[model samples]
Target: MHSSSVSGSRPCLHSFKTTLPLKALAFSTMMLPLHSINASKATYQFDTVVNQNRLIVVSVENPTTVFDKTTHLHGFGYDLVRSYANSLNVKLEFRTVKDNASALNMVKSGKANFAMTTASFQAIEDKHLAGFSATCDDSSVLEDNGLNVNLNWVFKHANDPLSQNASAYICNTKQNGTISQLASFYNRNVVKDESWDIIQRDLTNRMPIYKASFQSTAETYDIDWHLLAAIGYQESYLKPNSVSPTGVRGLMMLTHNTAKAMGVNDRTDPSQSIEGGAKYYDLMLNRYSNISYPDRNWYALVAYNMGPGAVSQIQSRLKAQGKNPNSWINLYSYLERHKASNSRYGQATQYVTRIRAYLEHIKSTPQLVNL
Candidate 1:
């Protein structure tokens, strides 16, 4: 027997004529090879091959307050990278390093798809790694006084257009997203009778403001001015003579232990205090990297006030309440609920509330720029 090709271009089957018993003929038909037939059917069924999308790994230095803010408040670079990956139908991964050098190496070795840190390209050679469209503004608080340190995004190369473009887009997106989230959160919690405008007015009226400086020095540590001011407002209202009941002293209010950890011998010196405070906050932020933003920030504040261990206990309580353990609001509410009954909780609440109020005041009054 022979079978004709459907298109008549080629023979589909071949057969040989032979004298055979009906039983033999049935056996031959049954034993005919089916592998070729299955292969042909499969070829027709799947005419094209689809390639898997490549995965991107974004790396960062040990999580700092800035990274916390970006991740928690702005969804770190995750939101942006995720959106891009979704569009391309790819996957995004994150890797973190203990320091800047390691983070750079990750990108250079192609172990990471990109590096996201408060890195300055001018500080390093640009040939090995590429930065995205985002420039991170590093915020720091003074040691003796809470002051703001603002640092701009740093990239690996000065001439890379891709890095520049990525930096611009990221900055804009972060700014818009942060503003929106802050506003929404504020509106939800703010009392109807408490005017944000009045809060702004009071903050603006506060005096003894620190001078803004962007320069790096042994004394100043080259922190961003605004960040320092924000810290100052939070810690002690930028009052150089301010002293916490716990003996944290100076404008940035450096505890003896905290100052010692940051290698500050002169806790009373404004410059030393600021540097120590900034470094300490950086350390605290790095310690809580897994906490995610808004929560990261919340936890950092809690750690700053009640200590990390106490915050952990509060987090457990928050988890029990079906609230996000990392949210500032939930933490704040929990602190309030526990303050009356729990001595440790009461102390933590007092500290956290003060910081929250100061942060809110700073956010509302841009005119307090002098501070």
Candidate 2:
């Protein structure tokens, strides 16, 4: 329910092009819990389909078309909706489903507050069951032979009392506060990184091959080893031969020009790619050095995926709104609502979220300590 207004005129900033820190505080392995203070304990008389303290978002994995699986719920739609929930001081609970049809059924059945698996309301087989929020990412939905082809939208059960709340919050025109600035109203606790015993179990075989390279690269770049490994896992799942559809190659998915710039001759070489990506990541970190811990790495990862220019533009926008552009959570709210398509806000946010999830997983792994 909390909100702020952004100025209509967008300001441009070029200061982000300056030098960044080559070193950063090592990411803490200690896990922290999110804020859960309810000392005053004010209860709301009206509790809609959404839980009083949480929002249940139904979705399915559709990386290219919807939510990025690597990051869980960090896509454009997810970010936008989640930001709204956060504004209301509610935690988000994402429910994975088999498909959009099933997602709609969940909402219709009152199981979830909304169905947000990149479905266009117009294309739904049963349109009467749900209503969609005003499309934020585009002007109108595109139809390919009467089926949703291109358009991003979310839906809630037509009968759900919280549907209006969902609509108002999702498409609400307001300024999102930066993390550093949110102490005024943000009451949630911060969650600490968890142990990655599960990830280590899965990576047992590959650890022997890449552990040394991960350690060496991390040291050379003055970054956490797990970060490098997390990026590798997200980009190509630690497969040295992996190549992205856009021509990014190798374990870290370095593009041709990026590889050359980093002095990498063989993009497919695991060691070489890891080194190059690490160096590039370190450089990115330096650029956002002014940003605080956690957020610094978050911005760097976004820059690494979407390029520094896009992130720079985002920072500038945040600054124009009298916000701390250095705060990722603050930026997430703005990025979620931004109308511009070129910024790649959705993809960049998702990329960072996924990298963070992986980093946390790796940090939790006790085996990494030995390396």
Candidate 3:
């Protein structure tokens, strides 16, 4: 339950408990109750958690919660819970679970301090565990398939300090419009172009053929395979023979020039194209070497579609406006303006947006469950 109890080992960036399903890497730890004095909060009985060190949270992946998973924790619920953890100056130890029920059970059983909940103000038939639902659920698709998402942090005891503080944090953020800003900020990502039926069909019919290529290519670049798969799906719906008018083709829709540059000889070969795309994507990452990841990943992805020159232009524009150039949320309104004025931003934004949407499905696939 506590860090000291985990064989004196510190969990790396990615870890989880997968009692019910496909995959995870983990060590057992949980959040402990509050100490009698502020100075004593760091101590624990079973050593579930210490205020000065770790705050463990459990969640099922959904857009409203964690849309991504263990490799990199991300999502709206992840953001909210991370903020709360930051307030306490503790490291957040995110634990992924198979369902809402597993998450609740973890909290009740003291394996985590709290659980992040993403329930429909309407119900969703299919579900998966991304970190908070973590990274992938932020957007619906390029189209408007938005839904009202209600997320909450569930605690074991209503009177516990972790619970009370989380409740207070939510209330304070809501009162200050921080929560609203986050919701509005993420509104652009709620796109669902593929119906659940289509997603299932593709999962069954198409995914197995290219899974190894996705896994190998992504691992070479230290990228999540699901994220790479998302980009591929957006490019050609995972069709090995598909081609665009501009001549981008194959599983990854690689242009002839980009493919050649990345050492790919066959544009129609799935493995070659996937490898080429990963290389090109890695090249985009190098273009913004100064920025940190997740943000770097976002920028590189946009650059993959819009060209590094366009991303540079956006950075310059944002800097001129005194905004953070490295952040994707800042690009949203700027891209919207370009779409309004000249319709130039649609393809680039669509490129990133669809990747975002497809990632949720790729991560949520019932059979494969690529975390």
Give one clash count per candidate, in the order shown: 41, 16, 29
- Rank order (by TM-score, best first): 3, 2, 1
If scored against the real structure, what TM-score would every candidate get?
Answer: 0.42, 0.48, 0.64
**What RMSD, rounded to one decimal, does every model reach?**
19.8, 16.2, 11.3
| Candidate 3 local lDDT, 211-234, one digit each (tens) | 888899889998888889889887
lDDT of each: 0.47, 0.56, 0.61
True-vs-predicted CA distance for residue 270, candidate 3, Å: 2.9
Task: Please give the ranking of all candidate structures by lDDT, highest first, separated by commas.
Answer: 3, 2, 1
Best by TM-score: 3
Number of clashing residue pairs, candidate 2? 16
Q: In candidate 2, which residue ranges exceed 4 Å CA deviation?
A: 1-202, 339-343, 367-371
Which candidate should be chosen as best, given lDDT against the real structure?
Answer: 3
Candidate 1 residues 129-155, lDDT tens each?
433323133231111112212112223
Model 1 — TM-score against the truth? 0.42
